[model samples]
Each structure stands twice: as structure tokens, then as C-alpha cells.
Target: MNTRSQTPIPNVDDTTGEYATFARVQVDRWRDGQRETVEDVVAEEVPIALEYNGISHAVMMATPADLEDFALGFSLTEGIVATPGELYECEIVPGCEGVQVQMRIATERFVALKEKRRNLTGRTGCGLCGAETLEQAVRHPKAVAQGGAQFTVQQLHAALEQMQARQQLQQATGATHAAAWMDAQGGIVLVREDVGRHNALDKLIGALAEAETDFSQGAAIITSRASYEMVQKAATVGIGFIAAISAPTALAIRLAEETDVTLVGFVRRQGHVVYARPHRLR
Candidate 1:
């Protein structure tokens, strides 16, 4: 698969892996039948290549920041590694055209990954983009480990409110999505943001792994709508319940039902819709 991590571009933050998230640009402003020049900060989008065992896997278009966390989260949520330790090493090498995240995995896992690669694999953002068959497209996640946690609508609202405070990049760019881990008591534990909602969730999931968190113990919230792929990614790691500030795709709701996850959407202060597994909600 040719995941083009866009051709490398010259950057100011060459020394630090932290590439700039946005750049100032001059644009013509037209409002009230008036025209003026204004400086605007636009979110930076770059190609981020993920290479496993020295071989390329995916090239994702993403905002360049919190990459180490991105690498870990992508690996775990993608089922490339069952545990954080299965991934041995990850290195970031900026190329002439894009950035490459080189990852080394346990030998056995590496072998399994290769064995699973087939003629029909690797797709774009959709969960089944690269799927070769219906069975693969609808692959089920492992049963969630048991956990007893319940919360009120107020708690879910509070947790989402907390997410708003931690979104440094999104607040600045207005072009990013955030996926956050929130405790049952409405505490925002971790947040990861990306231009891609999947990437944001993946990064947050990775950060949780780095902290050795029990996925079943908390809920997930996304600033964007929840899709089947989002639910699949969360379920792959046993995230039992997920809330979205927007709506849920029909497929996402169906998958949530099959995966035994609580799918909540339109998470406003006054109300929220529970699509599946409402037993987990109070």
C-alpha cells in the first residue's frame, strides 16, 4: 500500500520530533461587503508513515505532534500488538518527503502480522476499506473483560466539558478532533487530538496504554461523530462505552450492539442518546 506520508517538507522544528501544528498565513478577508488582508493560523497537515519491522505499513495524513503517543495508540488499537510491551521499539525519522515512525514488534507477532497480509488488504480511513470479504469487514472484537461501572448523564456531560479545556491544538486550529479517556466520576484522564478522528482515538488509546490503564474502567469521548471504525477501534481494546459530541452512524450503532459497548451520542449538558448497551448507563 502506498500510504504517502506527503513528500517531506522543510520545517523549523527539525531538531525536535514536535513538528509545528499550524503556520501563520496571510489571506483576504471578506465580510460586510468589505475586503481586508488578515493573518490566519492554519493547521499543518503532513504525511505520517508507520513502518513495522523496517517495512512500511500505513501512511496517514495527520497533524504532527504527540507522535510517540500516536505510534503507540495506532499499534495497540490496530491490533498490531496485543500489549504495549509487544512493541519493542519505535523511532521517528523525518524523511525528505514525510515522517516515518519505525516500529519493532515481538517476533511472533511480526510473523502473525505478515501471515495475515493478503492480496486484498490495506484501505483508506473506513474500517473495511481494505477488507477482502464481508467476514473480514465485520470481524468481531474480543469479548470485553468484565467491569462494573455506571454513571449519570451529568457525569458524561462533565467529562466532555473537561475535554474542551485540554484541546490545545483543536482550540488553536479549529481543524482537529479529540478523543479523550474519562473516568466514571467525570474526570478527564487523557486526551489525544488529530486531524483524523480515528487517529485521535488511537493516540488517546495509546496514551492510556502507556499509563497502564484498564480500558474497561473508563469511557471514551470523541469530538466528532462516532463511526463503525471508531467503535471497532475502541472495542478492539475493550473500551466498553464511548460517547460522541455528534451522532452515531447506523453501522456504528449496530457494531456497538454486537460488541457489547455503550454507544452514546449527541452528548449535551441536557441530554444524550444511548444507542446500545444502556445497561452500563445510569
Candidate 2:
């Protein structure tokens, strides 16, 4: 892939003010009997350095949009902060190299983060990196409240359709992942996209918290396979339902069961497989 782009430029639409998350690049296309140069749009992936109280923490490859949500959500889900209030300020600084999310969190939370030594070099495809200990590598989340929300199969299908329709970035680039929040009636309320699946989920989680929505009252829909980290993030925020467009890892199933989350995978228009707490789907 010899595609080239500038440092994740944010092109805002004049009317809607929606950030353009893709970059136009020139590429060679080989068809059945032809080869030609063409202009294409690719999802933007850039290094996002997260700084806490001026201390550099993890550097991740992610799409540079909704970064404020990403910082807050990452802080909360990663156990750096117990509540949203613990995070006082989030500032995004874009540079020629990449983007930086400068966050000022509660003193106690920042102190705890330093104690864990959780410095990471994260890629778009992987979440865990630079963990020095087994305990730090695989941390468990608090168990979510049991038996909170239920969704019918029809609602699941409807939400899946809605989410797919709403993913403008994926439609444009086909290189991004989406995470959405589905209300109790299966209406897709909020969606976030990123080059990294975990980043998308973190954005959605952060947006939900910022909107003051009850995490336990709805479900999360992801366009990627469910990993243990995904389950942990959702459970940490008390989301009881998680539906993935692909399969679930064994570790994800185990964590979902332990956290009282209803995990569903291979979600399509016709069917889905429930990996845990099947009763949540009627």
C-alpha cells in the first residue's frame, strides 16, 4: 500500500460542520482487463499521543476526529479515571507529525495512572502493548448490573441496518470501524468511527458519558469482532448489551459472562449468535 496523505487534516463542511475523516489520494486501479491511475479516499490514520497532566502516556494510531471524546473515554475505560468528573480538561493539538490529546485529570487519577506504568505504543489493529506485568496486561472490570435491558431480534436487525446506513466514514473509505449506541427500542442513537476498533468504542463511550446517557439502558454495536478488551471497556461503563458484526474471542466470552454482559457476535441482518447472557435477546 503506497498510499500517502497529510497529517489527518480536519476538513469541516460549511453547512453541517461534520469533520471529513478521509483523505483523497492517488492510486493505481487494476480492473479485469485494465490498469489506470485513480483518485481514491482512504481513512486517515495518525499517531495520537495521549498526555495526562503534561506527561506523555500512550501513543496510538487512530483517526483524528472526536478526539476529545476519545481522550475522556480512554481515560475512563482504561481505569485511569473512575468517573467523568475526574477528567477536568481535554485539549487537542494537531501538528505536522500527528495529533496530541492533552488532558488534565484529577490528581488522584493521574497518580494512579503513573503507578501502573501503562505506557503503550498502540496500533490501529491492536490495543494491548507495552504492559510490563501480567496483572497490568489483563485487568478486569467491575461487574455490570445484571438483568437491565432486553432487545428483540427484530430490534437488533433494525439497529444493525441503521448503524450501517449511518457510517459515512466507512462508506467513503471502507477502512474504518464503527461503534454505535442503540437505545432500548433498537434505535441507533450515536455512532463513532476510527481506524481502530477500540478507539471507535472509546469515542462512543465517551460521547455517551458526555451526553449524560445511562449506559445500562442501552446496547453497544460494534463493526469489529469482540475482544476481551472490548468487553472490559463496555462492562467498566455498565453497558449490559454488546453486539459485534463478527465473532467473539474465547476470552471475550469469559469476560462478558463474568461481567454479566450479554455478548452477541456474527450479527447480520438475518441472524446473530449470543455468546453470553442470551436472555437479553428475546
TM-score of 1: 0.90
lDDT of 1 by residue, 1-282 (tens): 998765345254556646777778899999999999999877777788888898777777777777888899888877779999998999988777767889999998888777766222232343455555677677678656666467777788888889999999888879889999888576998888888888888889888889898888889999989988899999998999899999999999988988888999999878899899998888
Candidate 2's clash total is: 0
RMSD of 2: 2.9
Clashes per prediction?
Answer: 4, 0
**Best candidate according to TM-score:** 2
**Whole-model Cα lDDT per candidate?**
0.82, 0.90
For each candidate in turn, the TM-score is: 0.90, 0.94
Candidate 2 local Cα displacement, residue 204, angstroms: 0.2
